[model samples]
Target: MLNNYPLLAKVESPSDLRKLPRQQLKPLADELRAYVLDCVSKTGGHLGSNLGTVELTVALHYVFNTPEDRLVWDVGHQTYPHKVLTGRRDRMLSLRQRGGISGFPRRDESEYDTFGTGHSSTSISAAHGMAMAAKLKGESRKAVAIIGDGAMTAGMAFEALNNAGIPHGGLMGDLLVILNDNDMSISPPVGALNKYLARLMSGNFYTAAREGAKSVLKNTPLYEFARRFEEHTKGMVGPGTIFEEFGFNYVGPVDGHDLESLIPLLENLRSRPGPQFLHVVTKKGQGYKLAEADPVKYHAASGKFDPAVGFVKAATPPKPTFTQVFGEWLCDMAEQDAKLVGITPAMREGSGMVEFHQRFPTRYYDVGIAEQHSVTFAAGLACEGLKPVVAIYSTFLQRAYDQMIHDVALQNLPVLFALDRAGLVGADGATHAGNYDIAFTRCIPNMAVLTPADEAECRTALTTGYQHTGPATVRYPRGAGVGAEMTKPLTAWPWGKGEMRRHSARPQTHGRGTPRIAVLAFGPLLYPALKAAEALDASVANMRFVKPLDLELVVELARTHDALVTVEDSCIMGGAGSAVTEALSAQGLTLPVLQLGLPDEYVEHGDPVKLMSLCGLDAAGIEKSIRERFLSAPLLRSVANE
Candidate 1:
């Protein structure tokens, strides 16, 4: 159940928020923080980011004229508060559900969501484009890009700042970049501006004089003196000088948690001209004590749990997840070889490299939020005769497509890419779904694209890929395995090979001879294909390798069966199913093929189990689809006569 916040419950939209008195805004932010923790504990979404952005979200909405003035949220993980203030408060209960609102911002969902974003560091670019568009059209509207410190490390964010440095009208104006600096580890400001801004923001006299101070500084020679003073004071302490060189008027290291301070600063910056960079300092999980201590663990939440007690690590362990399986295998592999290196793009926790990093800190490399660098960096390590295993998500790997192809595949480097979350990622939806990796990786030269059926096979796939003398990928689905036990010892599977999961003795005909049918499945889809095969009395071939399709098995099976049906968790177009067809076509074999996978359209957010059945990849849906198409009267008539 969604918790009702007295102040927050009253405000239906940003217009309602603007109506509240300045004093009530503090109480409203407090209520909003509690409400997010309450709703997310029940429904479960991005918690740490939303908790961190509560005050900032309130301050921005209260100051700016949104809908008219566009605000782009980078990555959209911290948008729970933004969603609440923009007429989606009631929809918070159904957050990331099938027919409800998305976890990330969607253009179709609302006009407030200026640009749909799930990937990081595109906010500045999108907002800058909007500012230029507004300037060209002669509209008096501002565009602000709210980005996190992690997101700013991305090359795209820096590129956008560079682009905005030289604005459309040949002067720095309109575009505002609000860097939400939650990470306290990044060299903080030791100067008076931190205290100066904080003290000035607290009082009404300074807030009143802030607008006039801007005019005097812009017109008079005192402007350069004030700039020099700020530069000399916070040059080394803060990252202001770096942004200043990028042609932005940098202001802050301000108190983001204090509504009294953040609100007044936002009001002043609202009217200020030129490329303004406001660096707000806030803590992840500010209000909640337990979450504040360990923000990463509380980054996302699920089911009911009191904010007081917090998330107690589940004692009675459930099934081993695919991620956990990889983590265990990585440590084992690393222990066996000193030349082994593990790399992640700011996903030390998500990519299951925690233990690997802890055990071998020297070998573990967190390249921050730069995926492109992570891939090319691995190529460099492999060039120096070291085995580098890149632990990256299937969705994030999209950002480093060039490095994967040019640096790794082109040179035929011995780099293993462990692409976690390889199928439909449920609540994360289309933006995060890893449906294209199979198609994308298979097409590249010197790339071994392998998919594992269960937890046991996942470990083997990783081993098989790591030992291979070329660029190899082992893509696995998110969440726990299908009650499959993982092997203690590590071993590599045979290269470019697949095994028969289920084989029916003969084709079932209603008192007549009928042609046999076979289902060729890749990865997790093999379970459902096996289930569907039982009903049809068909054989199930688990084709693990996508690029090197087991031609020997496929040719023999095609000759035995009249119709061939291929199934995968990825998209039907150019997916593993297409690989089977291409192999058959090369040998001039005219086998009737049916391909089943995620359709042409993007799959929406929901429970992964439910989404599977909806996509016709589950047992019942797979059986119904197969029997309806392949088991047709006309197609099987010639075989039935035999």
Candidate 2:
């Protein structure tokens, strides 16, 4: 379908896009959007954000000398169009798949992706760094950061603005900060700033002021002075007024979709000196009627569907995602326990807390992309005897590590952390992967971590974490579980315990003629481990607890098996495998351990199986690694000989 557009299909690079006539740009954008929708529908990635940025992306690449003039995309969810235009058109189908282009901008992936970004609100800071570096090196390269209006709510964006506003060493490098106002960040963006900006941009005061200033300036003898005065007057009128205070030359409330307006404005800004701010208004799903009407539903989609009817909802037995499970648990617990409160950092919809917010508005707090504040806020609520359940992604929680340790763990605050996406999150790639949460959280004192093997266990774990008195985390993987019947009634499992799901018949090599070689799996990845174990003729243990080590099970398994393999969907370093090794070492038991998990390097975005295999966490990979570690090379043989 995209090949039909000669202007688009012929353009392999941004340089090619720059040569196209202004009149043809809209058709090119249309083709780009169509191509994105088609590709994402098949691969399933961030759809709505990319669809929205199609024009903006084309305009940016066309205007800027990319690979030299750095364009840092905040959050990078909107970088799909950027990727497609930047010589990655042919490989678009392989996006977010293992060994393919990442869903988010990756510096390693392409030179055009000057800076890698996954989390929100980092673009300004990154652009500031690039701008500063260019100034220091005496280079004339421009640094432009395109951030969404939703991302602007983040504290880091403002912090970067404050820094960029300050003149550095008497040399002011050009930093163009384009605020792509889509008016939605995952959910309808929250906070006073978002509301204030929305109102200020929409108001007719700017229009009236500009018209009045033009008439007065044209008639007056002091034209330059009047123009300066007019600009100064504009500072008090609208949203750009606030940015002007931050020491930037404010431009626009321009139509982002209009190439005629956007191109000239960008050209003017490109020639200007110092920090320039452009507030471009854009729709979340521009062009596509269905997506435009309901952006949130199509925020990220699976792949090509009937644009007329929109995305085809996957027909499945109505089952809850881990996020839904946590959301339901929070509301259910809150209904019974008045002290139970819910907290999220600008992820109300993603974390599945929208219904909870509606039901318990007073008790639910959306902290607006402030992870650090969310953790500390939970700590404060905990101090006051209110049980605060922080529903955060494993990747996002990394932002508040100090707060988690100092505010919650050190003080032993009863903050139940419902960690969603606690494993290799497919498509979103390395940046969004929840691989390090287990390693980091488990090391903290007075911290408890639980991993659910299935959907039923996920519900139980959330309740279990909620009932606990100190800092606790119930980490669950992304997506649905292995069709296990979900049980009602929040039954609490014993903390730091493991359940043997299946046992081996033959005495494994690890045990003296005993069926002992066992696979200890954590989180939802346990299903694959169990399946692999069945083929390997080894025991499978659902090690529900990550922290506290499940010592009893560990000791028993150590005594029974000569070799033990720990498998998890997390980083091997300082993770489940490391925990098991620590436990066994403390007991003075020396067992050959084979750790099967995500590697030290970042795993690229792709299919879950492909990612797992790449990281040696898949069924075949796990079996092969274990067999190689235990059977192929016996360390005990060499030790005995020595």
Candidate 3:
């Protein structure tokens, strides 16, 4: 595969790429694009965004001294082309695999990856900081932020733009903010207006002349007319007037794929001073025909696929995902109650609100990439006596914690939080993992947290949370459960109560009076704990609620069993396990308690099954841990003697 692209094979790094003739860059970009498609077909990663950034990635590395001049990418999914050029070409095959390179950029992975990113709308602030740091250190290097049009929807990007445009205490960094406008709304087809104006704005002659004219015509009516005329001229052609007000020299909505246009424009902008904005037009899935037609379907390939034929649906449909269960529940609930409304923070597809949106268009709200706003907006709706359900990923909900506390929970409003992906997420790594929600949400007063075990239970949990009078959360894992039947009616489960799935059959006392063990599992880990209970003869309780936490069940199990073990999929510290331990402390019961969950460290990207096994949360691992902790050698012999 490497040999197929001879030009790309020769480029081990950007240093080697700089040695190539300027005429060879176009051929190299073509080869690079082909290689990305091939590699992604085999490995399965971000497809559309990476395909869109090929030429831009090539031109940036060619024009700027990258490692020294920092290039920070927002939402690093589109950095596949950047990875290939920055000496990570061979590692493309190992993308998102265990013990391999990450799908997103990592600070520890490469020096060229100046900042790590996965969540959107952070590049502007980070790049401006780098530029200011370079200026403070007296370093002559540029700092560039390559942000997408979708990322620009967040308010944080504008906050950084508002600050970066002005000089900080008479000191400004050499910064460039490249808005990769792929939406195609503001930008029409590129023509003479785009190319000529982009080149003109980047030139030193125009910069000097504009400054000279202002200096000579100051305190005169002509100067005011000239300023308005310039702003209006740029405004009529493109969205440049807004950035000009932010104190940056605004350039054209140029064609990003045109290396000839991008290279010279970048070369000129690199030499310019203060802050500058370059609007480059690109398209998601630019080179691939199928992906270009439907970018959403091809956003990220799930598994290996034939590049020629593209992705094919399995003949036998797969089991419904957790998101699908939630979507169906939302529609069913909405049909029953007219006041029920569904909301998501730009994750309508990922959160499984498409069907709900189609059926109840008036009740479904897709707030654009604004998590904080979504929470407060839901609060406002709840205040009007309308039940608002926020279906969001657990990681993204972290961005709206304060809003959840002050706006919803503090006011004692009736808002339900349907948190999906509430555990270790594979491939996306620690940045996207929903490991801390349980720990964080349980601490707040008036917040009830529910951990459902299976698909059927997840639906019931949604109903339970929705029917509650105060703020409540129903968190479930990312993928499907253990094929549990979903035939039950949409109704709430008994409030804060847990059911015993399996009980130890052996006698309570043996020859040496060995104490019996009981396992309290919260969430999907209940399934694995059940398997482990078979081997250890331990009683398993599917602890449904993490907050109210079935205290009666805890005391009953504690009094009956000799040792207690708490299990969850969240962090071990300050998680459901900590809740159980705290309840025991409040009851003044002293017993052998073992806490099992995610370790106090960041788990990397890999297969979810393997990651769970590594964390000692699998069936075999759970059995081994229980035996080692409670059923020691002498106690095991005593039990076997019976």
lDDT of 3 by residue, 597-624 (tens): 9999999999999999999999999998
Worst lDDT run of 10 residues, candidate 1, spans 633-642
Clashes in each model (backbone N, CA, C under 3 Å)? 0, 13, 0
Please name the candidate that would achieve the greatest lDDT relative to the true structure.
3
- Return model 2's CA RMSD, one decimal: 5.5
lDDT of 1 by residue, 43-151 (tens): 8888998999999999888889998999999999899999999999888889998998999999999889989999999999999888888877878889999999999
- Candidate 1 lDDT at 80 equals 94
Error of 2 at 288 (Å): 0.4
lDDT per residue (tens digit) for residues 251-279 in model 2:
65666777766776677778767898887
Alpha carbon lDDT of residue 595, candidate 3?
96
Candidate 3: stretches off by over 4 Å: 509-512, 633-642
Q: What are the lDDT figures for the candidates, one per model?
A: 0.86, 0.82, 0.91
- Listed in order, each prediction's TM-score against the native is 0.93, 0.89, 0.97
**Global local distance difference test of model 1:** 0.86
